[model samples]
Every structure is written in structure tokens, then in C-alpha cells.
Target: MDLSQEEPADWWEVEALYDLCFAPGRTALSSYRLRDDVPPVAQLCLCLWDESDALAGVIRYWPIRVGGQSALLLGPVAVHPTRQGEGLAGLLIRESLKRARAAGWARVMLVGDYPYYRRFGFEKLEGVQMPPPTNPDRVLGLSLTPGAWTGVSGMVTRATPQAAGHKDATDP
Candidate 1:
């Protein structure tokens, strides 16, 4: 598969792929609430295409705050139905995470199943809270920098430039 950073021209295609893979009301989920008015991490938004040149999988990351500290919100990783079990999801995750760490992001979090995300080093975020209607059990996090998640807690909210420890890591 060929992987590339998502470009403006790929917006509709990426959205269509997300629509195809997730529930119709996916945007109603709490994660979307954090994404409102926030642009994703452009350098980390990745698209994977098969040898046939068809889009196979995608992953996106948004900047958010955890207790007012900068954090990455990873989500909406979608692998084409027919391409499931091909390890496309894992590939998308591993590649994007490497880029995220290199960009100076210290922490990453997501609302997802522990069984699925745990393999990627994600664990339950004990004191972190997402917006209402979201199950706290699904809030997970991984530290990109050693001890990055230690002592971080409180409400997850929209990110401000000040929240992003590395301004260049976030979209302007």
C-alpha cells in the first residue's frame, strides 16, 4: 500500500470512506465535539492506497487539550471492508504515530475499545473525562514521550495554540 499525508483534494474521498466504514451518526460522538472548528494534524492525516490505486485505509489526528495540556486525538481510522484483516489498520496507526512523535507531540488519546487499541500501547486514562454521553471506559491514551501522561487529567477540550507545546505540530 502507498501511504501519503491527506491533501485538500482528498477531503471528499476520505469523508466518503469514513462514511462507508462508520455508523451514520459517527459525528455525533463526543470525539467530534472536540474536533469542532479544529483542523486535524495535517502532517499526520494519512491515506493508504492499494496497488490497484484504490483507497484502502485512512487515519486522522486532531489537536486537543487534556487538562489544558496539549494532546493528540486519534480517530476515524477506517479500512475498506473488503480489505479488512489485511493489517491495513495497524499499518496506518504505526506509520502515523511515528510521524506524530517526530512532530513533538507528547501524548495521544482516543475513544475506543481497550481490547483493540491496547495492542498499540493505549491504556485507560483514569482521570480524563470526555463530553457527556461518552463512556469513560472507552477513553484511552498512550504516551509518546516517556512519562508524558503522568499527572495529566481533567476535561478534554478544544485545543488552543498555548495548549500545543509545539505549535508547528498543530495545524494553524
Candidate 2:
């Protein structure tokens, strides 16, 4: 299998994979609220291709803020049905996370099941809150640095333009 950074050409195909792997209303989830109109962390968004060159899996991360500190919001990762059980999802996740750490991101969070994500070093975060209707138990985080998540808390929100490495009116 070959891995590559996702390019514009892969958008529709990646979305299709996400659609296939998630429920019809997956976009309605609270996590989507934070991702709306936000470009993903370009280097951390990855695609996996099979020996036949078919798209096999994808993963994405977005910039977010928790208690005003920058954090990565991981989500929307999906693998083609044929790629399931082949650990393609794991590969995408691990690779993306490694890239995230290298890029100086301190922490990452995802809304997912502990049982499955635990293997990836994600654990339920306490004192942190996501938008309503989201189960807190599903809010998990992994620290990319020692003590990265220590004392972090509060509602997760869209990353400020500055925090996302972009400039908007909010920045001086």
C-alpha cells in the first residue's frame, strides 16, 4: 500500500468513503460543528492507496481550541469496506498522529469509543466539554507532549485564525 498527503483531487473520493463508513447524518454530529468551514491540517490529512491504486483509507484532523489553547480535533477517518480489518485505519491514524506531533501540535482529541480508541492511546478527558447532545464519554484526547493535556478544560471551539496559523480580524 502507498500513503500520500490528500490532495484536492481526492476530496470527493474521501467524502464517499466517509459516507460509506458513517451514518447518513454523520455531519450533524457536534464534532462537525467545530470543523465547519475550517480547512483540515493539510499535512495531517492522509490517504492510503492499495496496490491496485484504489483509495483504501483516509484520516483528517482540524484545528480547535480548548480553554483557549490550541489542540487538534481528529475525526472523520474511514477505510474502504474492502480495507476493513486490514489495519488501514490504524495506519492512517498512526501516520497522521505522528505527523501532527512533528508539526508541534501539543494535543489531539476525538469523539469516539474508548474501547476502540484506547489502543491508540486515547483516553476519556475530564473537565472538558463538547457541544451539547454529545456524550462526554466519547470525548477522548491524546497528549503528544509530556503534560500537554494537564489542566486543560472547557468547551472545544473552532480554532481562532491565529491559532490555525491564519490571520483574521481577531489577530493584531
Task: Judging by lDDT against the true structure, name the best candidate.
Answer: 1
| TM-scores for all predictions | 0.94, 0.93
How high is the CA lDDT of each candidate model? 0.89, 0.86
The TM-score measured for candidate 2 stands at 0.93
Cα lDDT tens digits for candidate 1, 10-105: 999999999999989999987898887667788999999889989999999888888978889998899999999988999999999998888888
Residues 16-96, candidate 2, lDDT per residue (tens digit)?
Answer: 889999989999998998887777787888999888988899998888889988888987888888779988888889988
Tell me the spans in candidate 1 whose CA falls farther than 4 Å from its real position: 161-172
True lDDT of residue 153, candidate 2: 98
List of clashing residue pairs for candidate 1? none
RMSD per candidate (Å) reads 2.3, 2.9
Assess candidate 2 and give its lDDT. Answer: 0.86
Error of 1 at 29 (Å): 0.8
Over all chains combined, what TM-score does candidate 1 have? Answer: 0.94
